[model samples]
Target: MATNSTPKKPAADAPAEETAETVTKSAPARPARKSAPGPDVVGPALPAGAEPISVTLAHHHTIDGTDYPPSAKLLVSPDYAQRLRAQGYATPA
Candidate 1:
């Protein structure tokens, strides 16, 4: 006797569940890291023929979920400063 039999799907009301191990295994990939920069660390690369200037930030700057506190100093040129601000990076004050 041939019969069509298929497994039933879980109910909509039932909350989807997964163990931490499986959750991490199937989680979305981590984002690629940007150039490392810090107060004691080297800042991002300079542009060709662009003059460098040290500027203080006025807002919290976050990169890849890593936050750079406001009022921190960064060495960046004027043009680069605008570009960074556009990207939600530290803005020169």
Candidate 2:
């Protein structure tokens, strides 16, 4: 008698079922990111019944080798942006 080292193939008549993890890309959903909560930034004022929202701020590196500090975001509202505009914060030409 001889031993068969060859593995037998799966039966074609059997039904196949995919598992939950296999159905997805095996990656979990991205979690929401939150900035550090502190009194570093003064919450800008908003109109009545309006709430403040967060906006990301990116520091720019100057070509002259000057660099700016990193800021996570600014708490801005419609009214606050308007006030900034009134202060000549308009985009440069």
Candidate 3:
């Protein structure tokens, strides 16, 4: 007659086997942020003998993605200021 036997496990006092499990994790993605306008979008320089007019811009004046808060005062060229006034975006301060 033959007998079957099972392998024996390590003793409690024995060191445990070391395993090298490679678990790779990717970094989380970040959201895009809005950038401020550069010199290129500031428009051309003031013309000779031309002065900027002080006008209060309305809340809707967000042209070129620039922030112009409501009742904000700014100096702009005469032609541009006039246009803004006509469009109800600005008023003389």
Model 3, stretches more than 4 Å misplaced? 1-44
Measured against the true structure, the TM-scores of the candidates, in listed sequence, are 0.42, 0.29, 0.48
In order, the Cα lDDT scores of the candidates are 0.63, 0.49, 0.63
Error of 1 at 31 (Å): 6.4
Q: Count clashing residue pairs per candidate.
A: 0, 0, 0
The candidate with the higher TM-score, 1 or 2, is: 1
Q: Judged by TM-score relative to the true structure, which candidate is superior, 1 or 3?
A: 3
Clashing pairs in 1: none
Indicate the TM-score of model 2: 0.29
lDDT of 2 at 89: 39
Looking at model 1, report the run of 10 residues with the lowest lDDT sum: 34-43
* Candidate 2 lDDT score relative to the true structure: 0.49
Per-residue CA lDDT of model 3 for 7-45, tens digit only, reads: 787798985565454335557776444343432323245
**Candidate with the greatest TM-score versus the true structure:** 3
Greater lDDT among 2 and 3 belongs to 3
